[model samples]
Target: MNWCTRCVLPDTRPGIVLDAAGVCSACRAHGTRDEAVDWAARAAAFGELVERTRALDRRWDCVIPVSGGKDSTWQVVTCLEHGLHPLAVTWRTPGRTPLGQQNLDNLISLGVDHVDFTCSPLVERRFLLASLDRFGTTAIPMHLALFNVPLTVAARYDVPLVVWGENSAAEYVGDTAATHRLDAEWVRRYGAVHGTTAADWVSDELTERDLAPYFGPTDAELEAKGIEAVFLGEYLRWDPEMTARVAAEHGFRARDEGPRTGVYAHADIDDDFISIHHHLKWPKFGFTRSFDNLSLEIRNGRLTRDEAIARLRELGDETPYDDIAKFSAYVGIGTDDFFARAERWRNPDVWTRRDDGVWTIEGFLVDDWPWS
Candidate 1:
């Protein structure tokens, strides 16, 4: 229930630690990035990498994993601006919106080879439901595919570099000094699949072959093949608003409906089901996507802690009802069953049921939270 003095994020968020000053690790990491990071030096290093990859004279100098999000578009624009020919790759979410597809097409029209890697819909459905039933989240399959697809493409195509957008560990988990390589170890730590790999998810229903797209080349294989998967965030500064602006300048469109899951119209908008993954955090960690987005804004000096709190109060009852219905239908489950399974994973430490049969977080940041 401990909230960061600098931002609205709580200590309950996994991998977030509050130091003695009551500042969360993520905010402290952002401070370190601002004060200690030598962005000019990092940019020079990236320039060298770009030159080296270009000199390889391959068909594609890099593989950029993308979801048509602002960050991914920014990644593509940055790579193209650096004169690196990157093959854009998408994992093809089952819940992709029309806007998502349009943005993806626009990114491809930015002039690069693209691959829309689609796993079997049957397998995806089974995996989605299994992930929901077992891990209490529907994002495991999506995360697995997004992480694995581009790397697999890179290894198979002999692309020397895989350009990932950002290091979630550094930005979200306070691991500011994380290795630039997005290898198996990094996946195990920050892949958001509960530290489980594709092999671990094999079940009676989902065979190894059915989950082939989820398995990427191992670190050893990547090393042997001289395939280096790196985070572009390590080389260049990454701010959410800045990235969104860059994307908007490059023909990326924001949602007309606004703020699908968080404070940004541009984020987490690629997949309809992804919001459910973030919404479930309210029950499990006592925070919503608004907390995450607002924390970043506070860290970036766009909002005060009090202002972020007010925004959270305004964004009450962030229960992705339509998304839940669509996802439930896709996974052949009822809406009642969906919530019932989500309820099973509610963190007892963060939530308490009231006498009136409503769940509430006792030490929540918002004093008058509209708990539904």
Candidate 2:
């Protein structure tokens, strides 16, 4: 539960490394981007990639997996602004909020041809509940489909390129070696599913064929089709607030108020269950969305470390019980069962209960930075 010297991230976060100086790997990674990366050169390389993909005999130059959130909208606009035709693809989350649906439709209003893929609700519910029951997070299936389905569509449409958003390794987690890779193996290991494959989720009721959409193509198939997937964030600087502003100009809307659990008004707005998913991180990882959002702001130089720490203290662990109740109803589980399952998933290495019955993490509440 040691905190990063430079950001609000805890050492308990997976793939995070705190150096002897106490700076976390994510802060170190951002330092590399700021100090060494030549954005002009990267942009040039991206232009070449766009040209090569556009020359392929396909209806679209690339497939951009979108959530109709600010980042996806920004990705679509970025492709269009660079003269690349992108086919936007969305794997619809089961708990689609009204605003989520409207924002998703906004992508179409931007004049791009869009495809929405939905799973059978019965199967999706079963998978979601199973994920909650086993992994303590309901986002496993959604994460799997988010990364897999777009590539499947790319192969089906004969599109040679798939454009993804940020590289989590570069922005959030992983060692320096992973900062620049977007290969299937890298994604399979560190992407949202966090090494949990669809094979791990197969059950008596769910067959291989039923889970095909969640399974990405084999490496040979992807290579044979000449599919090249790249991260747009690597080429262009990624600032969530900036992207939200840009997307707002293009008909995207943010939540009227900030979400119950996080600082961002626009992020994760497409799914009502996202807040619950983020809230669960507190018990499991000792930190949650506030740490993530504030870290980004810290990296972007928008907030001082003190301000970020204050914000995290004020808002980080506030659980959105309403969102949790919604998710429980969606998965046909009781609210008590939901909390019981959440408690089961808490990492004892990171969390302890006080006499007052409040959960807390050790070595995380810093009175000041630059700890000696």
Weakest 10 consecutive residues of candidate 2 by summed lDDT:
363-372
- For 1-372, candidate 1 gives per-residue lDDT tens digits of 899999998998989999999998898889878678889999999999999889999989999999898999999999999999989999999999999999999999999899999999999999988888788888899888999999999989999999998899998878876788798888888888889899998989999999999998888899998989999999999888999999999999999989899899989888988899999888889888889999999888999999999998888888999999998898888999998999999999988899999988887889998877
CA lDDT of every candidate: 0.91, 0.82
TM, every model: 0.98, 0.94
Candidate 2 has which clashing residue pairs, if any?
Answer: none
Mind giving the per-residue lDDT tens digits that candidate 2 earns over 264-337?
88888888888888888878987788788888899889998999888765653477888888888988889999
Q: Which sections of candidate 1 miss by over 4 Å? A: none
